[model samples]
Target: MCRLTRLVACLLTLLFLVSCSSHSTQREAQPGLFLSSNNLPVFMSSPQVSFVLITKIQVPVQEGFDQEARLRNTLAVLTEMAAEVGANAIIVTNAEEFAAAYNRVSTGTHFLAGASFDLSPDAFKHVQLKAQAIYLNR
Candidate 1:
């Protein structure tokens, strides 16, 4: 009876791990909001389309992780933010990378204008991407 109980526990643990792994893997590949400069000319030329506002969006840096994964997550955040504002599309105007350096080690830090945070000198590295969030009149 003890052996059987142990086996059941082990199987449940395995199942839990497998489920968590599969869920994370599926999320990493999903696409976010529309990103492009191709439609700039078309959107600009049309009188119907109007510019909303220019803003900067930052995605938190993943700690000691894969660059591709970090970028994917960041793009997801940007997409969500744009969607919240009812933006038609996002135009990346510029980007800047920020880091906190301590003992010759650099880590990313996230910051935005008119926002404040309290953190130790050494935090992390953050990529601040400047984008123009636009919404069409019609």
Candidate 2:
């Protein structure tokens, strides 16, 4: 009899916690910005004749719980940037040291439910990526 009472109490507590999750109270994750532009401005690290126009760049993006999805989006942006410059090589100068946070949002439909979500920071997180890359003209 005591065990049953304890179980009931635990279940009720769990339900209460889930229901009390107000939107304002929920922790928001920082969002990654990708593909802001294809042809990012390039600055040469050295002064050389017809220097390979590469930029020391930083992409301050990627935040959320969905790591795989965020990584995919980030990679796509970098690829487009590379292609735009007709570059054949990229080297990392620096990488960010944090994982962006995100949450799952769900919507319901008649006899079914659907949902989609993205990285959006409720509380802003400062993140940056830096790279010194050399792009060989293709």
Measured by TM-score, the strongest candidate is 1
For residues 1-138, what per-residue lDDT tens digits would candidate 2 score against the true structure? 999999999999999998753221111222123323344333324323332534434453454445566554554555455444444334443433423221121111111123224323422223343444344432
Model 2, residue 97: C-alpha shift (Å)? 3.0
Per-candidate Cα RMSD to the true structure, in Å, reads: 11.8, 16.6
Best by lDDT: 1
Candidate 1 weakest ten by summed lDDT:
22-31
Model 1 bad stretches (over 4 Å): 1-50, 62-64, 96-126, 136-138
Question: For residues 1-138, what per-residue lDDT tens digits would candidate 1 score against the true structure?
Answer: 999999999999999888653111111122334544333322212244565553434444443345456544545555555555445555544432322222112322444444346543224333343344555444
What does the lDDT come to for candidate 1?
0.44
- Candidate 1, position 128, lDDT: 43
Off by over 4 Å in 2: 1-53, 62-65, 96-125, 136-138
Question: What are the lDDT figures for the candidates, one per model?
Answer: 0.44, 0.40
